[model samples]
Target: MPKSKRNKQVTLSKTKKKGREHKEAVVNTMKQAIENHNSVYVFSFENMRNLKFKEFREKLKSTSRFFLGSNKVMQVCLGRSADDEIRPGLHKVSKLLRGDAGLLCTNLPKEEVERLFNEYEEYDFARTGSSVTEKVELKEGPLEQFTHEMEPFLRKQGMPVRLNKGVVELISDFVVCEEGKPLSPEAARILRLLGIQMATFRLCLICRWSPDDFELYIEGPDDSDIESA
Candidate 1:
């Protein structure tokens, strides 16, 4: 008799991966954005903050659409090569979607988009495993910022602190974080408690694509050229 197939282990190659439908939806949405908007941009970002990004998205909801997801999916949506491109020069834009990048499809003028992208920046709290950019030290003194109830919590975070006359006092100088070092879980929590924000979230435009032209900005574009595009 053949062994029962029930509860049998399956080979990895035979196991189906999920999210095909989701990737298809993303591709469809991107294609629609390309059709609906006058221009599309490839932009790179640093220290992405979801809530702040959501707020930024809300501000441009009426005139612009942003897509942030799998780079491979985005590339496929735009087509990887000129032969398969959905639009005349979109494949050029797709080639720029390398790392920490996204798409912005908009009807706004190029000048306005550039100005907004250059001016927009947000400061957010650093997370664990994020590199510290500055030294954060707490001098030996009374920490008026924290209440007596926070004493135990501070101590658990490796802070040399105690409750003194209902105020949290640092018994000795404490270095919460150091520059050029990766933040630890306790260091992140302490920095949050102290209201220190080390992460700067910003977006930079890499290139622009329109029905008529394709422009790359890394080496810089002439003012006349940008205006004409």
Candidate 2:
């Protein structure tokens, strides 16, 4: 009824339309990536770091390209059913494009692809809302890494701290984070300050498609096996 309400609905509608367009774009690009490259490898990744992943992409730009986006869109690009298959045997490989995975299109050999994936690992601090991989606790003692001036800020991060002479000391033992629990904003900050890296970025090849002979190879566990597990 109101102008503000109508404007809000229009914004929401635009946002939804934009998201659909993005998915369609990813599907088109993925199809192109499959068509242009010699081999297509579907790789699963966890805790992806943007900067490190970008660096890896830049390194492989000359000979390869990586496409990461919605798994459903990727599956659609590869063809979920025979009727809409992108290529002769792409539907078989598309079935393996599940979970947190992306398409890696390259002209490199299998050994080279495996080696590059292995070497491109990234370790970084976990973000807010990420599950803590390990329990972290700080004992009540002088924190030599910090100065007395940092005590106030440290206290704001839910740490019990006070200035002891010229150094910062924890007033009591604090559990910075608990394993398997979502990290809070304060917890993530404290973990960073403690130099704890809780996120590991790695990729695993789940499937491969060779265009020359139009063959599909499913690696690791296939969809049926994963469903049973």
Candidate 3:
């Protein structure tokens, strides 16, 4: 019988790695933006909503550029030390790029940017694992908000709901979520169905850098303060 090669072993070196090209492209783009823009900013975000962010980015496309990705790649682009920084004082900005932070290069005046960031905030539905800010409870009564056909769906979501004479009814008081506790999958779904939004998707600026100087806006202990970049 001839030897069969149904399965062949492959060497580690033969495998293709991902994201190298993307990293290189990002590095090149950052360098170019630094050369063209008068200022750069480090910003952080909470409860990010991609659609809303896309809309915000589109509005500033004519005057500014935003970069959000791996912090390490951005740090590398700015360089890690004063000696190797792409620009003077850029390494300081690089150091602040930790945890859910991104870069912004723009031609807008600092005051205009600060005002825009300060006034921007959007509310969104909370997701699983998000902490509930307030208690959400439903009293025992007929649920006119939902049709009888939705009884089964509500029951599946852990609600004490039943169909009573073609209407959804609650047999007992139900607590969808409690304050200071993380939301479960069931709770999140219930809140959405109830049309209650809990998450605030906002961006906050951490620091700013220009050719002449660098400034730190977040000098307080709580860097999580909400504002725009």
Candidate with maximal TM-score: 3
Q: Residue 58 error for model 1, in Å?
A: 1.6
lDDT ranking, best first: 3, 1, 2
What are the per-residue Cα lDDT tens digits for candidate 3 across 1-229? 8766876676768856557897899899999998999999999999999999999999999899999989999999998887788998888888889999899999999999999889999999999999999999999999999978889999999999888889899999999999999999999998998999999999999899999978888774533331211
- Predictions in order: lDDT: 0.90, 0.80, 0.90
Give TM-scores for every candidate, taking all chains together and pairing residue i with residue i. 0.84, 0.81, 0.89
C-alpha-based local distance difference test score of model 1: 0.90
Task: Residues 8-126, candidate 1: write the lDDT tens digits.
Answer: 99787775655789789888888898899999999999999889999999999999999998899999999877789999878788778888999999999999999999999999899
Off by over 4 Å in 2: 1-16, 19-26, 212-229
Please give, for residues 1-229, the per-residue lDDT of candidate 2 as tens digits.
5576645543445443457777777777777777788888878888988888888889889888898766777778878776788886677667777778788889898879878777767899999999888999989999999877788999899888888888999888999999999999999998888888999998777767785543333435465643332
Model 1: weakest 10-residue lDDT segment is: 220-229
RMSD of 2: 4.2
Models ranked on TM-score: 3, 1, 2
Error of 2 at 149 (Å): 2.0
